[model samples]
Target: AASSGDLNWSLNPTYTGCSITGAVGSQVLSCSLGTVAGNTTLPVIHVQSATTPADCGVVSNQATVATTNGTGGDSDTANVTILCPGLAIEKTADAASVTVGSTIGFTVTVSNNGAGTATGVDMSDPLPTGPGITWSIDNAHTSGPLSCVITAGTLHCTGSLDAGETQVVHITSPTQWTGSGETEVNSCLGGTDNTGVYDNTAQVSASNVTGTPNASAQEAVLCPDLHVTKVADDASVDAGSPIGFVITASNTGDAPATGAFVNDPLPTGVDWSIPEGGSTGPLTCQISAGTLTCSGTLAPGASQVVHITAPTTFADCGVYNNTATFTATDSPQTPNDSDSTSVLCAALTLSKTADAASVNAGSQIGFTVTASNAAGGSVGTARGVVINDPLPSGTGIDWSIASGPGNCSITGAVGSEVLHCTAVDLAPGASESVHVVSATGNTSCATYPNAASLTADNAPGLSANASTQVVNCVIVSPPSPPKQHHPAVLPNTGGPDGRLLGLATGLMVTGGALVLGDRRRRRRS
Candidate 1:
């Protein structure tokens, strides 16, 4: 039996067995035993171990011995020795955002607050597996290709702290993480002598055990999490104006946010901005190297904020719909803190255009009425389709009622009425084009080559796109001067080159419509 620092206990070599010892710490033990022989003293085996620590063998707080004390009249005393490990290192992450294919960073802090100087102590975090995550540490944190200057990283780390000393570690290299599962990470790490006493470097590994498990400290890690949502739930916007909204970042798990962020593809007519509190914010935002570090130092229930600016004006008039996703992640918790929300936009602006701005005096003039959006061009589709713009004077237009009109089949002057169209149930970002044909006057009237403007609405409340097409009646004129009539072929009377070009262009024109259905553009004859 022996007395160690602050505690006293006894054990007889003759005991039934070595009594189970202390808590999960280390200590020093000694014992004395011998057999009486050769007159006075007997032979004895004085066995001593350089280091006898709980972490070395008999792994747990329990210990074993060779002497199972019985009734053999063998009396002896032995001391149990315990050894304390070197120093410990810790880490904390200030994650601003976590998005797919992004790197997370952790501000690692290593401290040797206990007695005993450790030669090489390394602190690091493990890379989580899933859709888009990687493992990377800072070069400064790791000394050379395989060394960490400050007892932290995967390789040969240098001098460690004495009692009450502190150090730092920074992790980098990982980006593009999937937001589907958990992200496991690690914290304080170390090992015994690297040259002689080979000890496995300590680290935290992903426990295959699924389901929501609690967190561990001594074995540190960055548990993952994520959340996504819209600033406001609505998605409809005026065609010509803009509406404001936000994309919030949140965490709804036991682990704090590691590398967190959110990206919303602004629906048609809708536009999304950047995040705040990060190195890059305001206009355009991005997550850079170690931007979203996961250092396993967040207490449960901690959270940060990200700013999202959305405008409804870009959304074409009609119920505009879209989706916004928020992702909040912590290391180790592979894909954690995930939430998604559907967004909506209201029809804000109103307007439309005619198929043709001017119709012939006695011929049919086609007008295609349409509803368009003013803003949120990317917000997707709009729901409602309503239009009501008045038509101009002097031209016959079937839609000339509200816009100034006559009959579906009639030939008149240049006067048209107003027109109104309503298409509810229009899906978000959805649109339709309606055609209205009108007639014109006879060749004898001044309105023969009629002129009229048919105002229309693409999306009520939004801006309008208008195209003007003029139709002149077939000419009923006196023959040009003998020379001009036959051009240079008949006589010498000549016309201006511009007039000739105009005539040539008119002669080349034919009744043919060309509408290219394409995303960009194409060359067609």
Candidate 2:
């Protein structure tokens, strides 16, 4: 019998199987064992019967046993070693170009290609044009020949590189833009690319600047100028009448002449007199103002003429002289000029009023007057220029009111003795006057109006006014007298023209920045 989990030892004689060997008293035995963990017993044991009754090495009591080595589990172990690359230089930028005196940028990279990591990498470079380039540690851009080291393009670069880690070095050159040549920048110590760095220079050029380019720059222009001349009409004339003369002014300069005035100075014997308001600027004759004042602009080589009548009574008129003075000034450019005509004085002879004149006291009568010039100007060849008939002595007029209407008497201003006389004359050799009708205000009087003179010649006893009362007159005589013009000098040493010449001669934001890498020392594997 057996229980599931229990062990029991038992002996059975019928199931015996055994073997044993011993001495003479030895015997054979057969035995069997059961499941050791659960059953501990012998199935049977057979032994040979021998002389010794107790010879069966008798298995005293059946027993069970087991054995195991004193060991727990399993264990194993392994070990190994490795290496990284060393630090080496690298160049991101090898070359560049710029206009002369200009600037450019580049980069240099350093890598830790070694067995171990490296820290605090540095970089730098050299320059030819020292002032044109700057070196940066933690590469930074700077003017003048400079060198520097960088970490991430920064000057304040503080970086570390493990084995195979890389840092970049930057380079920048700001030039002064001067030359037209080229040069190369070489890698000195920390060349990341191990190549060349260079900047090529070019020449400078310029173009014309347009309109008011510079504030103080003046506007440029060309000026114009002119010329003038004067001449008499007749070859000769009587002693007491009128003379003829002409003035011609022209533009002769290359440029246009504007704001100009023509001045003609009158001669002593032959007066270049002007009308009441006609005479302007003290006998410095003006075409418009009669005394030589004119308003106009003249083109190059252009010409104009002024006709004049010279009333004369020959007290002294052999040769009368005069001249045309043309002055001009223009705008934009500086300008100055003055011109004049030639000189001449003519002769004259006077015829008196038959020595003693006779006329009705109440009835108007007349007298004769004449004039002449050696330069060929004439007036009254016949009758010796009678001082117009009936009106001579009877008329009354006022010379005071030169232009407007006013009370009139035969009396002329300036108490001119010649004007006082009913008739008067002024010629070179002959000077005389005549008294006609003695009537007071019975008829109009005076050969000329209250008129002053345009150009008057002198006559003895005849007031300058008496013979010169034709200044404001429009109608003119032919064969003008030659004016004893003092041919206007170029006014270098004398005259107001020179004084004016003396007066005119005088005039005398912020952006960002990029930096470069660390200074890395290269090492071998």
Candidate 3:
């Protein structure tokens, strides 16, 4: 017999000669045999109907047998123990995949599935590390008597749960996502895959149970990164000269980047033309309204280059710093690069020419100095143009501003003086000249060399040299006059007339004495 409201038991096989009877929670068994042989055994087996946490620890069962008429009886007892309280945990996330910089939300549920209440139960979910990653627990949204807290980047919950009871905990990063498990900045993984993957696991255990079931959730992160670089063929370019620019753009993320483009505006007097191949990869380029634009799509780890051919005839002289920006669908910010090139305009030239290569001693010689601004490759005006001509050290040289379209002037005295010609501004294809006339000094059989230099505000300086030879001691013969025949013989006017003699005498006084002497000798013969 058993007490009321206790575990019940029943026999598996019914014995033909025995009978069994019992209430719901209490039962009894009886067996009878007539004239049983000595040392013969009779089977007695029983099965438990139900058990609970209250029935755990030290349980016992006893059996008694009696021979016909209760002549003899024997009893035996057996003891057994029962264990209870088991824990199980499951984890789930809101999304299976997310962008590199996005946050994720997770839910963890722990249940006590065993027959007894579980005390001192603990649940832990450790977060993965990434760029700017953070984790937090949402206590307000949690269920059950569990108190959740975060320490060392992990979320922990501890409490007690009754049989068939469950505790729900919500995990997230409050800084970026309030209801999510954690927030990640997604600093690139730095590989061709351009992806980040991690797993979050939640485990539950109780004081009575050392081992428990744990669940995990996996997530795959993805994003696209864009980068750009720009360079020029020549840093310093002349006006109207061809120049080339190279622009390189790439995507380092796992996903493809779209709507990628570059924008560049040309400076004044600068012309642009599409390159021979246009652009590399899947890019197309065009120039409109002095602005160049190139667009294309970029695959993961793909790069595109755009070459621009431009002729620059800028009217200004300074540095031209150009910047190009790269952006993509998944890029959070624009990446930009800059390349600078300098332009030099206006071309000025100077030249000096003497009227005669040789001159008599004491005779005046004339020289002309010219300064010009070339037009073909020049875009700017030559401002503050100045031409300087240094003369021989003597008082016989005289100079004056010859001709110019711009306001011009000449300063400085003769001889040891310098001829200075200045203009406020000289346009391209414009020129100015200064005439220098000098009297030959008493020193004969000598040569005088002169040099003139020019400079402009927008062009490099120039210099020119000219030389004049003065010879007064050489005897040069004169050409004979043509003979005349008038039917008969005419007067010897070609022989040597008084006028010719006077011409010879004047020539002798002017360093042409050689001609005069030759003429006189011919007349005497």
Candidate with maximal lDDT: 3
lDDT (Cα atoms) of all candidates against the true structure: 0.37, 0.36, 0.67
Let me know the TM-score candidate 3 reaches against the reference structure: 0.45
Candidate 2 C-alpha lDDT tens digits along 1-525? 111111122333444333333333222233443334433543434222211112112223222222343242232322212232344543433233332233345454555555444444333233223323453433242221212333442342234556655555445545331222254332221122321224222111111101111001111112343455666655555555566556666665544556666666555555554445422221133433235444476666666666666566545345555565676544212222322222223233433232123322223333333333233333322222223221222234222212211211234333241222222333334433333222223233224322112123332222122221111112222433443324344434345332322222211101111222232222211
lDDT of 3 by residue, 1-525 (tens): 433345666556656566557775556766666677678776655545455545566566676877766678888977665546778888987677665446656889998887677888888777765554566667776887777888887888898888888889887642111111244244344212433555788888777665767899866556667788989877766544566678888888776666767676755455667768757777677788987777877777888887777665435455667777877545554788888776657667788899899887777776788887778642446667777777755434455544443444445555557776654566778878767676665444567788888876556778999988777655555666755333332245354332322123434455434444433322211
Instruction: Please identify which of the two predictions, 1 or 2, would achieve the higher lDDT against the true structure.
Output: 1
Give the Cα error of residue 142 in candidate 3, in Å.
8.6
- Number of residue pairs clashing in candidate 1, backbone atoms closer than 3 angstroms, sequence gap of 3 or more or interchain: 154
Give the Cα error of residue 26 in candidate 2, in Å: 99
Off by over 4 Å in 2: 1-221, 269-290, 330-525
What TM-score would you give candidate 2 relative to the actual structure? 0.23
TM-score per prediction, in order, is: 0.26, 0.23, 0.45
The candidates, ranked best first by TM-score, are 3, 1, 2
The alpha-carbon root-mean-square deviation between model 1 and the true structure, to one decimal in Å, is 25.7
- What C-alpha lDDT, on a 0 to 100 scale, does residue 197 get in candidate 1? 12
Model 3: lowest-lDDT 10 consecutive positions: 174-183
Q: What lDDT, from 0 to 1, does candidate 1 have? A: 0.37
Best candidate per TM-score, number?
A: 3
Segments of candidate 3 deviating more than 4 angstroms: 1-60, 65-97, 106-121, 129-153, 156-170, 174-199, 215-226, 253-266, 273-276, 281-299, 313-319, 327-335, 342-525
lDDT of 1 at 459: 34
